[model samples]
Target: MSETRIVGLRTERGWTQERLAEVSGVTVRTVQRLEAGNDVSLDTLSRLAGALEVPLRDLVAERAERDDTGNAGSTDDIDDTGGPAAGDDAAARHFADAARSAWRDIALGVALLVTSPAPVVLLIAGADAGLVPTSVEVAIAIGLGALLAIALVATLHLVRASGRLSPFLPIRQERVRFGARALRWAERLEGVHRRQRTRATAVACAMWVSSPLPLIVVALIEPGRGQGLWIAAATAVLLVVVAAGAFTALRTAWAPYVQAKLAPAVEARATV
Candidate 1:
């Protein structure tokens, strides 16, 4: 069976595999397998296509074209190890720079979003614990102010990042021709990112599962006054831990995620 444009289509809309699965009513693993070029039933394909709002034929046809071009006997643009040739060094650099910028902005924005509530949480908790000489209403007002400011900053940053990728968006959406060299570069980039993502995700999962432990321990050990402060502190710590993990994972994954969407572009040219 021919491959599908699930990855490109999904990414074009800025949707993750989990998001796509949720919208399409399928398992995340199934979406992963499908994007990995595994075979699937027509019903499954139809469901995914419907969710992506694209005709099923377009998805299958797009990949078929790419497969054909990739299978063609063309090694002039490839090195001995099947990597991008010297001729493509400039193109690779340009693509890498753009991809890196977009990745950096997106990761930083996500980090901001996750950590945005930390200040507010800490402030409110501290006020409640009497550590800060402020009324609860005043604390809430200040916290909300901080939260809104951070949220606005993050929103603007992400929007700018998305705008910066306008040139590459077509390639990502598979609307333009992409060469084999770019595909190889994307594959290599993805391989490196995969390792980093694995480590970060594992760490994040561990942190998340243990986040509540601190609060639990504090509550159990101290059943008297000032316990609220400790509990609030623990909650603040929990948010920070979650933020760090999320930031690390997303930071490591962004470039590859964006580039991977371009990997399936039809390799009809000698260079990107």
Candidate 2:
């Protein structure tokens, strides 16, 4: 492919040479050389086109046309069908679904962590008001503790499952189909930054931490007081805000990854 076409495509996507190199599995030096119109091997060209989400022939043909006519072709002449091979579309769909499911799993974990204290709080309140016997409260606490333990286990398992996938490792078909879809999706996704995953995890933790604050505030305020309703209303508002913030943050962090991961498959399908 012509260096100008490669450079144009990369710049149009706002990709730096380093970013392109990382996504294309090439060295930064190689990217620089290619951009400078140095000859690149067929394999290298193929990688670049894949990473840039364009057809290989389009790059080669555009370069050939430019050389023959002594005029660089228009950007519109380059085919933008940078998509995965046809056979990969099914795998891509599965990975996308898995990524989405993993997010839900994480959300469920956060919900469990956030709500874990509710039973205990209720038990304490009931005992203080002489509405519950000591024996019953003890039993309830034990049950809730067990439930919390189970929730924690499930949460950790999900987190581990969603951890980063290693591209060098051979992934089993069953795993791709049934487990760790998040990792699979990440492996397939181009241009996913570590910061995005970190931010998403942080936001989820923050949501869990903040979720109980409203209930704690309500507990500190006397329910027998005339302001109980006001306290409840305020708590509801706070919970809503926390939920909304978590939703927005998680979506912001993961949406790009998902879109990038699926772009090739989507484009392939479109071309068909």
Which candidate number would show the highest TM-score if scored against the true structure?
1
Q: List the residue pairs that clash in candidate 2.
A: 53-82, 54-82
Worst 10 residues of 1 by lDDT: 78-87
Q: TM-score for all predictions?
A: 0.60, 0.36
Q: Please report the candidate that would top lDDT against the real structure.
A: 1
Q: lDDT, candidate 1, residue 229?
A: 72
lDDT values for all models: 0.66, 0.55
How would you encode candidate 1's per-residue C-alpha lDDT over 172-210 as one tens digit per residue? 444433456667776787787787778878987888788
**lDDT for each residue of candidate 2 in 1-272, tens digit (9 for 90 to 100):** 57778888999999999999998777999999988877665446545765776655555565657755768544332233432222233444444445555565565555455445445555554554555667655846764886688568657846643542222011211211112443355455524545665676687677667866776777777667434444444455555546555654554444454555444434434444
Q: Cα RMSDs of all predictions?
A: 14.1, 15.1
Write out the backbone clash pairs for model 1.
Answer: none
Deviation of model 1 at 141, angstroms: 1.1
